[model samples]
Target: MNDTPGWASPGSAPSDGPDGKGQDSTGQNGDAQGAAPQDAVGQGPQWSKEQPPPAQWSAPSGSPGSSGSSGPGQTPPPPPPAPGQGWGGQAPGQGGWGQGPGGPGYGGWGAPPQGGGWGQGGWGGPPAAAKPGVIPLRPLGVGEILDGAVSTMRTYWRTVLGISLTVAVVTELLVVLLQGFFLNDSATTAALDDPDATPREVLNALGGLFIGTGVVLVVTLLGTIIATALLTTVTSRAVLGTSVTTGEAWRDARPQVLRLLGLTLLLPLIVAAVVFVGTVPGILVAVLGSSDGGIALAIIGGIAGFVVAIWLMIRFSLASPALMLEKQTIRKAMGRSSKLVRGSWWRVFGIQILATIITNIVSSIILIPFTFIAAAISGDGVGLLDSTGDSGWAFLIISGLGSVIGSTLTFPITAGVTVLLYIDQRIRREALDLELARAAGLQGYGTAPGATPGG
Candidate 1:
């Protein structure tokens, strides 16, 4: 009789148990590998080879044990080799430890062969190596991604919040400076009316505007890059419970800034180019046609331009994150983002649109009053009381103040969501949760010997 915990009686065929392992009738080798032979009652043969052998045992062809047919009076043949070895006396399959066809170890039913176990194929077959920091694409609920985003924020709130505020302040300052000099009513009115103004005067004014705007723009751009890089670095480290200094974050960010900037500029440029092309025909028709025809053509062109712009934006929405986090080039990152986001454009679009609306609404609430107060205090209100006096300067100052306030309020939300969305998508597509869990020091993560994180 088999003495194993889950084995069956002697003379019975092997039966599959709940765990998918086989059981012998004699209740012998019920352990994962199988049981040993028992002594015979009458001593005709100490052990009958005809009885079903342990799970590992194999018998030669034409042998009673190999035939799997037992008779009441017949003596059984000797058992075969151990369970993992095949009848040919070879290991089930070949590959490095934990590197197999199904991935690493025995996988689910019908699952492709993994690495690191018997019966698994080699690397030349399917990919069996599990990698770190990569995840598989799967359907994810909105709440789940949101939860992850919130978790990320909690983990890296210091860096994310600080950088966001810094970027917001810098951006606000730039906007204020630009509005103060160029977007003022005095500048606009003067430019429009001074048709005979000296070219030098016009050039000087334009130069001031351009130089000021350019300087501010450069600062804003740098701030944005710094904010995004720091946020990504902090979030990733926090999720892993690892500490990273600002210097380390900058190091990681500096190398990818060019690619990120290229991607950023390219996406908008492509959209603008498409919109320009779409509108060109309409513009041409409007210039050379009757009023009604021109209006119709212009309307049609505008609609087409809007649709194409939306489509292009959706196609490349995830590129920024891919470029920054994966250290990929602009083209490759765009391609990777496009591939990963396949069939999920609408979801991403909805999230982005919602975030935009929310940020805008919040900013409006805070800035609207500030604008009114600034305009009232800046002498602009005097124009409303007395039409003879020009309040253009006052209007400029008021607008600048409002702009500064608005940008300051809105920057954090915008930057935070953008970075968070990128991380969320990666988690959904790459089984990033498991990788992150392992990184965060969770037990059982990468605990399996030879198991890689991203595989």
Candidate 2:
């Protein structure tokens, strides 16, 4: 029976576990070639006849502090050779490497391979180093997940930032133009706090507010779909140790754009529907009975709706990555995400929440100074401390630039984490580490020319 722990794929070599620490760091020799045996050109370890056999092991024979049949001053004898091996085999350290077995008479990891790790009698030695990629092909911990996301940004900044900045700049410029030239923000501001405002003024302000909100929502939705689709592709390639260009990402993700848009639209509408559904009973109560009772019902309904929204949001949080990466239908993508999230709702929720909080904090730190600068540069007769409804394009443009820059900086991180989080969940549940390793071109991660471990 296989003995590797829960976090690692079965029959895989010793490596890092979920805690992001290597299983064995004692510096053992790699396979007979001074590297880990590769099951494929770009994957993690897999067992086959072409690879070395498992290490040889035996139980301890002597009692503690007692040398069997020899005097106390004498050393114990070396363990027997592997089964069917001649007694004249090379001794420990003769062929170099091999920490001399993890225990007495256990001679697999350290033994010299007779066939360079694939021969009839040899066994595997130390595993090779994981190939450089967005992440190592193993179970990931929190730190590893965070690092993988950042590494993609650092490694492919040109592509990632290009996509984000392009989307950001377009949205930014458009928002500024609309706010400055089209919307009457001063009237809206006056209508908001001034109770004596005429009905026409208030109605006009409401109309402007609705238009601005609708436009903002439309642009934000478009930007998010584009960003998520392209970044998901980029991050997937990065996991395979491949670099992607913005154009390549765009082309690859183009097929899924409409589907992604549908999903993006559907999710929010679902949340809104849930919240609206909760409010219906309260509305009915107000119409049929007391206002006070309706108020209480409404508050309770809103609270319940909030809890359900958070639950559904977390449950389907991974759908976008799955949709892009798996090329699944919208319904299938949601099913896949929900399946992955079934047993580990709390863990995924916590990580998603944590990533969002960190991203927001970093963005706020970047945007605060830009806000001050925008206020200082306003020239439309609005004071620095006053609302910017009357301010000229200078304030709108400057403040919007800050938002663009902030989004550019923060977008990759948020998108990358979501992708990596999806992968991590699969690794934990479906032995996806092996596939990732193979995809990453690790030596020992897939089927070879002989018997497989699974077989």
Candidate 3:
């Protein structure tokens, strides 16, 4: 009778239980190699050549099948050789192990052939990794990560869409109201375009433009931050094949929202500071000397700074997810992001840009028709451009509806990609898949003590 754990697939050397050995024909336990058999001196009854059915193969001495020992002079067959182990040798890959075409220990009686034959491409390899969630518990491919994000959105549409739509509608409403009340004035644009306008008129126009743009930017940024936080929770839960309610997501994410906001705000500042520093020398040169030369130098410096800013942005792209998932402070989050991004900067940047492109494409597809419809309804196509400030409430409302729809659909994609990317990175670098599998309660990957789930 075989005495191996059910979970221990055939051919794998049983690491525990039953002393990891079976009695030979002489009824004596020995190394798992094809060495000379011992004489039947002090040995018990020998095993028969004919083996029992697979059903009787069970694990260890204390296990059920161990009771099927031979009585008196009767003999019982030995259990099958361990997977990846030879007739009486070590598992493949260790030195001094049996040799065969498939690395070591490729040819043992009843041992599955190495490379291909049994479960998961032959029992030579470890069992296939478990996948309790959207992705397999291993390093992910580019397509896998992207697919995982889409899967999260599809599987948890209720919670994901609810969070997205609420944030989108609220933010779009605020923007539409702001534009309808304070920003759609034609005076600001007209004055700026009028060369003969006095200094005060131009100043007023510029001031109004900056103020309107700033307000709109701040509102949009806030909306994005909130959506990202909520969806980060959702995507994370999806990884464990668990669903989360919008309220649960919010409750989990709320505590870290402020820190996320600070991190979000700080990254832009850091980028701007880099750009400003890069352009500073040119500014000084222009002030003290030739304007042409200064302008040229400033342009060059600005480009360099812009390049650096992009690098920094990609480097820190993961901070929001890190902060939300790890319950980390802004500084620690940024540092964590930096650490994860190291040696993978180009990959992170490429994925982020790809996600951005996909979202933008989707947004454009949803928004263009609404824009045309808004222009037609308002009877002022030019008014749709903020410069005219003549876009009526009808135009604002229609366009804002489009904005909401676009944001609602696109928000999950962006946030899911970022969070999944963060997870992919950790799985590659930290073997997080093991933790994830355990957390998901996979059969073989039992929870380690003190081990927590999620990032």
What TM-score, computed on C-alpha atoms, does each candidate reach? Answer: 0.57, 0.71, 0.73
Compose the digit string of candidate 2's lDDT tens values, residues 65-94.
222213443323333333222222334334
Error of 3 at 235 (Å): 0.7
- Cα RMSDs of all predictions? 12.8, 14.3, 11.1
**Segments in model 2 whose C-alpha atoms lie over 4 Å from true places:** 1-129, 198-204, 379-389, 446-455
* Candidate 1, lDDT over the whole model: 0.55
Model 1, residue 320: distance off in Å is 0.8
Cα error of candidate 3 at position 80, Å? 25
* Ranking of candidates on TM-score, top first: 3, 2, 1
Model 2 TM-score relative to the real fold: 0.71
Q: For residues 358-424, write the lDDT of model 3, one tens digit per residue.
A: 9999999999999999888777445434233577887888889999999999999999989999998
Tens digits of per-residue lDDT for model 1 on 1-455? 43332222321321122543332333232221222222223432344435653444333323222123244323233333344542222255521122111111212122223333322332243323322222122234555444444555555556655666666666666665555445443553465358888887787668765776677676677666666666666655654556566678778788888877777778778887887787777778778876677677777887798798987787787777678778888999889878766777888888878877876887788778866765575654465432122344455455545655565545545554565566666665676656567555566654543333433
| Candidate 3 ranges with C-alpha deviation above 4 Å | 1-127, 380-389, 446-455
Evaluate residue 6 in candidate 2 and report its C-alpha lDDT on the 0 to 100 scale: 17
